[model samples]
Target: MDPYRRLVRPALFRLDPERTHEAAIALAERVGRRLPRAQIDPALEVTAMGLRFPSPIGLAAGFDKGARAVDAWAAVGFGFAEVGTVTPEPQAGNPRPRMFRLGSDHALINRLGFNNPGSVVVASRLAAARARGRVAIPIGVNVGKSRDTLAERAVHDYAAAVERLWPYADYVVVNVSSPNTPGLRDLQARSALGEILTAVLDVDVRSAEWSGEPRRPVLVKLAPDLSDEQVDAVTELALELELAGVVVSNTTLSRAGLRSPAAMTSEEGGLSGAPLRLRSTELVGRVARRAEGALAVVGVGGVSSARDAWDKLAAGASLVQLYTALVYEGPSLVRRINRELARMMRERGIERVADIRSAG
Candidate 1:
C-alpha cells in the first residue's frame, strides 16, 4: 500500500492548501539532512545546458518558492530543482484562499503572485546551503518582476535579480509568462522579451566577470496559451538572443475542460495538472520543432508519470519538471518515474535521453 495516498495525503488534504504546503516545506527542511540519497540509474542521467542531471525528472519552481529543501528534493529522487518566481523585492502575494484543489481533475489553481522572500534573502539561504555542501544537484533560480515595478522598469527588475542570484544559480529563468502578475505576460512579446533577455544576459556577463565563474545559463518560461505563430516568434527571438532554454510554460488561465466543482474551477488563477497535460505537451513539441536543437526545452505543465515524462522527451524536451503531480502522487513518484523511464529506454534499445526524439 502507498502510505502517502492512504495516510499522509488524507491528512494533508484536510488542511488549507497553502498551510499544507507550508507544513510540507517545513517537514522537508527538517528531515532533508537525514534522508537517504536516491540511487539513480546511470541510464537515466542527462546533460543539458552544460549541467549534468542525474535524472530527467526535476522539482519545478512553484513548490520550492523560497529555495527551501533543495537537497531534500534531490534526496527523494529529483535530478534537479528550480526554485522561486522570486522578485528583486519581496511582496505579500494575493489574499489567502488563493490556491484551489480539484481532486477529481487532478489539478490545482493558484494566484500566489510571485510571493517570495526576494532575491537577497533567497540568495543568502542558497549561499549558506552551498557553503555546507548540501546542494548536490543543479539548482535553477526562476526570477520574476516585482509586482510594484512599473512596466518600463521590468528589465531592471529582472537584471537586478540575476545580478544577485547568479553566483548561487546553476541557471536563471526569466519568468515573463506567469499570469498572476498583471502585466507579466505582456513581457512575453518578442520586442519586450528581447529587451529583458538582453538586460539579463548583460547581468550574467558582469556577474561572471566579478566572480570569475562561467556565465550562468539563462532561460525563459512561456505561457501555454500562446498561438502557434506567437510561439514561433519567441523561439526565433530566443535563438537570436542565445538563451540556454525555454521552460514551456508557466500556468494557464483556461478553465476549458476541468471536471472540478464550479466554485473551485471558477477561481481566477493559473491552472495546472491533468487539465494542462495535452496542451503543454503540444507546446513542447511545437517549441522543440522551432528550436531545432538550438535551445533546450524544459517540458513542464501536467507531468505526473513515467509515460508523461517519456512523451515530453519524445516530443523533444531535454528535461521534465512537475509540481502539481507531486501534490497528488507524493515523493515516491519521482523514483518510480525514473525507474520506469529507464526500463522503457532499455526496452526500446535506447541508451541516451537525447535519443528519445529519434527512437521512432
Candidate 2:
C-alpha cells in the first residue's frame, strides 16, 4: 500500500465520509494547482461521442457534484471529467451522516440524494472552466430530479436542467438510477424513461441549432440492481431514441457480498466500490452485447485497479470511469491505472484502447 493509505486515508476515513470528501476535494484543488502535469502517451487518446478523450478513464459524476473540482481532476490525468447529478434546483439532500465508509469491503454507502448547488451554479462553473481552458477533455454533466419534485413533474425538472447546462456540457446524463432519491428509480420504467429522454434530447437539438454544433450526446445512468429484463427494456429505449449511450450503473442498493458486519451493512443507501465489481461488469457486458454498436457504453462501479478497468473494457465499455477507488487509492490512482492499462494494451499487441471494446 502507498504511504497515504497506511497513514493518511486511515485518518481521513475516521471522519464523516461526506466531510472527508469535501476536505479531499479541497486539498486536491489546492495541491493539484501546484503540481506539474503528468506525461501521458499519445496512444492513450481515443475519440467517442464526437469528442476526444486523453484516456478511456474518466472521473465519474458525483465526485465533483457542482463542477467545483474539474480543473484539479482534469490535471490529475483523467481522460475526462463528469460533474453533478445536479438538479433543476439546489438541494441540501438527505440528513447528515448520509455517507458511510466500509473499509473492509472497499466500499461506500451514500444517500447524498443528488445534493448540489443546482444546474445554474454548475453551468456557471463550467462556463468559467471553458473560458479558463481548465477543462480540456470532454466534460459531461449528470442531471437528476430534485428531491422535492414530484414524479409526475420529473420531465419538466429534467428538461429545465438540460436547457441550462447543455451549452457547457460535452454531453448530458439523465440520471434516474440513484436509489436514494425517493421514486427516482421508478423513472427507469420504459414509459417514464422515454419521456425523460425525449425532453432532454429536445433540449440537445435546440442547443445544437443555437450553437451550430452537432447535438451533444445524451446518456442515461442506470442502477445495477435492475433485472436483465429491465436492462433490456432500457436498452430498447436507448436504441429507439438514438440516444448517445448508457452509463451501465450508478451505485447499487443491494448489500450482497459485503465483508462488513451485518450492523454496518444494514445502513441505508446505495453501495459502491469493490462489492459492485462483478455485477456491474456483467451488466456492462450484457448491455454492450445487446446494444451491439448502436450506442456507447460507459462502465462504472467497483473499478479500483487496472485489471478491474480492463475487465470493464473487455466486456464492452467504450469508456470507463471511477469514483470510490480515488477515495481508497488516492489521486494518483488515475495515473497508475492508465499506466497499467497501457502496458496491458502493449502486451496484448493492441494499438488503440477501443480495439478491445468487445474483447470479452
Candidate 3:
C-alpha cells in the first residue's frame, strides 16, 4: 500500500491543507537525507527549453513558495521541482482560511495571493541552495507581481525577479494567471502580456550578461479559465515572444462539476487537480495546435494517474507537473507515473514524451 495514502495522508489531512504542507516541508528538511530514491526511467528523459530533465514529471510551483526544501524534491524522486510565486515585496496574502481542501473532488482551492518572503529573500535562498549543491534536479523559479503592485507596474516586479533569481534558476516562470491576485489575469491580454514578456526578456538578457551566464529560458504560466480565443491569442503571443514554453495553466476559478461542499467549492481561489484535467488537456491541445510544435508546453492540472499524464503528452505537452495529486497520492506518485509512462511508451514502440505527441 502507498504509505502516504495509507498512513501519512490521513494524518496530514486531519490538519488544514496549508498546515499539512508546511509540516511536510519541515519534515522533508530534517529527513530528506533518508528519503528513498524515486525510480528513474530512461524513457522519461526529456529536453525542453534547452534544458534536460531526468523525467517529465515535476513538482509544480506553489508547494515550495519560499524556495525552501528545493533539494528535497530530488530525494522524493521528482524529475524537476519549481519553487516560488514570489513577489518583489513580502505580503501576508488574502487573509486566513485562504486555502481549503476538497477531498471528495481530489482537488484544492487556494487564494494564496502570491504569498512568499519576496523575491530578494527567495532569490537568496535559491542562491544558497545552488551554492551548497543541494538540488539534484533542475530548479525553476515562478515569479509574480505583489498584491499592492498596480497592474501597470507589474512588469517591474517581474523584471526584478528575473534579474535577481535567474542566476539560481534553470528557468523563470512568469505567473500572470493566478486568480488570487486582483487584475493579475488582466496581464494575460495580448498587449499587456507582450509588454511584460518584453521587459522580462530584456532583463533576462542583461542578467545573463551581468552574471556571465548563458541566456536563461523564460516561460509564461497561463490560466485554465481562458476562453478558446484567449488561448489562441496567448499562444501567438508566446510564439512571438519566442518563449521557452508555456505552463498550460496556473489554476481555475470554475467549480463546474465539482463534488465538494458548496461552501468549499464556492471559495474564491484557483481550483487544481482532477476537476481540471480534461479542461487543461483540452487547452494543451488548443495551444499545441496553435504552437505547431514550435515551442514547448508543460502540462499541469488534474494529473493523478499515469493515463492522465499520458493524455496530456498525447495532447501535446512535452512535460507534466502536479501539486495536488502529490497531496492525495503520496510522494511515490512520481515514480509510479514515470514507470507507467515509460511502460506505456515502450508498449507502443515509442520513446520520449514528444514522440507520444507526435504519434497522435
Candidate models: Cα lDDT each: 0.92, 0.89, 0.87
Model 1: per-residue Cα lDDT over 302-325, one tens digit each: 999999999899999999999999
lDDT of residue 349 for candidate 3 = 91
Better-scoring candidate (lDDT), 2 or 3:
2
Candidate numbers, best lDDT first, in rank order: 1, 2, 3
TM-score of 2: 0.97
The residue-by-residue lDDT of candidate 2 on 216-269, one tens digit each, is: 999999999999999999999999999999998899988877899887889999
Counting clashing residue pairs in each candidate, in order, gives 0, 0, 1
Q: Which stretch of 10 consecutive residues in model 2 shows the poorest summed lDDT?
A: 30-39
Using lDDT, give the best candidate's number: 1
Worst 10 residues of 1 by lDDT: 67-76
Between candidates 1 and 3, name the one with more favorable TM-score: 1
Cα lDDT of model 3 by residue, 1-360, tens digit: 867788888888889888788888888777765565565887788998888888888999999899878878887878898998988887778887888899999999998887799888988888777787767788989999988888888889898877778788898899999998889999999999999999999998888788788998888999998999999999999998899889988889899999888988988889998999999999989998889888789999999888998899999998899999988998778888888888899999996677998776
Query: Which lDDT value does model 1 have at 21?
Result: 94
Candidate 2: misplaced stretches above 4 Å? Answer: 33-36, 358-360
lDDT of 1 at 172: 93
Each prediction's TM-score against the native? 0.99, 0.97, 0.97
